[model samples]
Target: MTLDTKKNAFIELGKFLSQFSEKDTIKKKDIVENDLGPLNPTLSQVFFEEFQNLIHLSQSHNGWYTPEQVYFSVQSWSEALTEDNLNQWVGAYDLSAVQPKNIALILAGNIPLVGFHDFLSVLIAGHNVLVKTSSNDQHLLPFLSKCIIAIEPKFANKITFVEGKLENFDAVIATGSNNSARYFDYYFKDKPSIIRKNRNSIAVLNGQETTEQLAALGEDIFRYFGLGCRNVSKIFVPKGYSFVPFFEAIFKYQDVIHYEKYANNYDYNKAVFLMSNFKLLDNGFLTLKEDASYGSPISSVFYEFYENLPDLQTRLQSEGEQIQCIVSNNLVENSIPFGQTQQPKLGDYADNVDTIRFLITIK
Candidate 1:
């Protein structure tokens, strides 16, 4: 398929997604598929209802995958997959020398639509995709992929969903925990692959942020119940930096703790820390504990003290592989602005690997 044809198909997919909102699963049929230039409107309507059912079913599939969280993922993608964004993202690469290859994706179920970027990258690069969906997130992406195929029949041959072992693929991209990553390395050792492992994001505080900025930072911390690799699991503050203002700023998100799954994690982790005698700062809903770890459990955020900015920057640079993305108010070098970590653009490749470039250069 031509690049423009692929781009147009995705732009229509974006329009189909724009009908659903994170606020609720109330389907809006008024936004017709004709606007999206879909090939089959009747099938599109059926798939639209399936989209709503999948959002509700996803929560039961994984307790952490709430409807609100699933819709938020959908909303982010709806905004990102527009014509201008896709064109600008694809224009950066030279596709004339590209050759289509079979790309296998082993998706992670930590959050909804976590593997969609790789799916999009392979298609936009004019290649076929073989996807192995995680059981936790099995329902959503496959449904959306079907929507894409319905929009453009050309993708039917380009996309395949494999239920068993992945075979007959030219390259691979897999996301999993650190243990699974090692296995992926050994299994796909001879192929051109992108093996992703467990990584966490951190935020830096310089004690000069506004209350609004701090509140937005709360979104970075709590979105998707803090399950995504992009979620800010740790924060670095100057010595003696008071967390009182930070707590007060994030009070608006207190309702997050009311969710039973999150509440259970809060209670359990708090008790474990108390018995272990770790000093913690509590605000009734969440806990902040002083530690040197980057990966914090649910409902808890690890914090550390940094005396010198230069030294901390150097430290983060040396540990770049372990960190996914940093969030701050430009306090550190290359840190993403607060509240934008989850809303990654098309070019914001995970682990800072240029996936499109990887696809272009693959032999």
Candidate 2:
């Protein structure tokens, strides 16, 4: 199919998704009556109702996929899949004469619809996609794929979900932990590939942040239950920095402790820390531990003392591969602001790797 056809299909998909959110699930009149041309009104209603059910049912399939988090993911994508955003993201590339190739994707289920970017990239680059959905996030993407097909039937030929081994693919894009990345690298060594490994985000605090910014940081830490790679898993604080203001600001999110899954993680991780005789600063809901590691366990955030910004920059540069995003209040260059790490734009490719460029340049 043509690029315009694919773009229009996704734009329609975005409109469909915009109808559902945590605040409300109002069906828009334009979508039901005007926008979906080839798709009959009855079929549109079926998709609308089924998607609402799937958003709630996703929690049963994976406890981390709470309706609130799922709705946030849906809303983020819906806002992103606009005509202007799509044009700005893809307009930089020349895809008119590209040869279509089969691109295989092995997705990670740590967050809701985490692999949608790769799926969208492959298709928008005029290539066929073979997807292997992570068991933890099996339903959402496929359901949306059906919506895309309904809008533009041409996509039906370009998308495939594999149950067994992936074959006949020219390239691969796989996201997993560090150990699984090793396997992907070796197995796909002969093919053009992008193998993503585990990486965590960190926040830098100079002890001068406002209560509002600190509270916003809570969203960066707690959204998606801290499972996403972009979540702030650690923090950097100046020496003598106290946790009083930070703790007070994030108190609004204490409701997270009521969730059984998160509460279990909090209890288990805290017990292990205490049994190991490690000192911890605890709120009723979250824990803060002083450690050198970037990857912290769920319900806890690892922190370290920074002597100065220059030295911290040097250290972060040296350990860049292990970090995904640096959350700060304009203290560091190119650092994402508080509460915005999870709201990456279409161009904010994971690992800073250019996915669309990789797809179109494949021979």
Candidate 3:
């Protein structure tokens, strides 16, 4: 797959994925399982846009280049994955000089179709993928694999779903919580793996965000209840900041976040807050409170306020390793949210891992 060739293929893939726009069958399982209950027209648009933005970002952004030049070698790998130069780049690596002949991909299910990039990396690199889909995301992984097969049927042979055995894999790429990483480290000893554990993501706020920016940032925080790695669980605000707009922007989602399980979490947290004498700004549905933990609260969202930049920086620095992507409104050293937080750029890859590089590395 030359760059041009791969680009052309993605163009076609994008075209085909768009056909599902009006199809009711895409959310068939969500409705039947009561996970999504009744699908409203407004919410339907939100769900469809998720696929549209992710697919578009993957194609247009070369998987979204890291402008910070943080992943230099990885960036080159992403460039290779594009439809433009894949053919010329394939087998460009001196695999005989390396040790691994097969690739093991330990996929995560936190978000929909999170492992597709790794799958693409393995197949494009001419290696085999031992994919373990997250239980929560079992649905989207195969669907993506089928999409690739539709594009190049021969690729169907190289990708595999590994259930129990992992030793056969030459190298491993795993994603999980910090606790799970401990288990993975204990289980897969000395196999040459990239194991990613739990990390909190935050947004750096200079307190200059526009109304739309504040609303969109709310989407990132409230979307999926901040269950994602990229979810903004905390904010760095200047002295005397008001959270009024933030509350309003995010309040629209209160009705939709009505799963009994989720609601239980919220109510439980609310009770605890009240019991502990914590103040809550309740505007009918959602509650905002100051919290220390990065994980999302059950019933509402939490953030710790900072009056000074130095103090916030020191705190964040102490917990830097646990942090993931940072969303800012063009603030210094952060990722900016465009529309929704869960919605990523076309070329964005998780943990700054280059899906294209991982694809071609083992080859």
Question: For all candidates, what are the clash counts?
Answer: 0, 0, 26
lDDT of 3 by residue, 107-181 (tens): 776544556666665654556677877665554456455555545555567677766766577778888988889
Worst 10 residues of 2 by lDDT: 32-41
Error of 3 at 235 (Å): 2.1
* lDDT of all predictions: 0.91, 0.93, 0.58
A best-first ranking of the candidates according to their lDDT comes to 2, 1, 3
Worst 10 residues of 3 by lDDT: 63-72
List the candidates ranked by TM-score, beginning with the highest.
2, 1, 3
User: What TM-score, to 2 decimals, does candidate 3 have?
Assistant: 0.72
| Candidate 1 regions with alpha-carbon error over 4 angstroms | 24-44
lDDT of 1 by residue, 1-363 (tens): 788989988998898888788664455655444234555546645667777878888899998898899889999999999999998999999997888899999999999999999999999998899999998888888888878886788899999999999999999999999999999999999999999998999999989999998999999999998999999999999999999999999999999989999999999999999999999999988899999999999999999999999999999999999999998888788899989999999999999999999999899
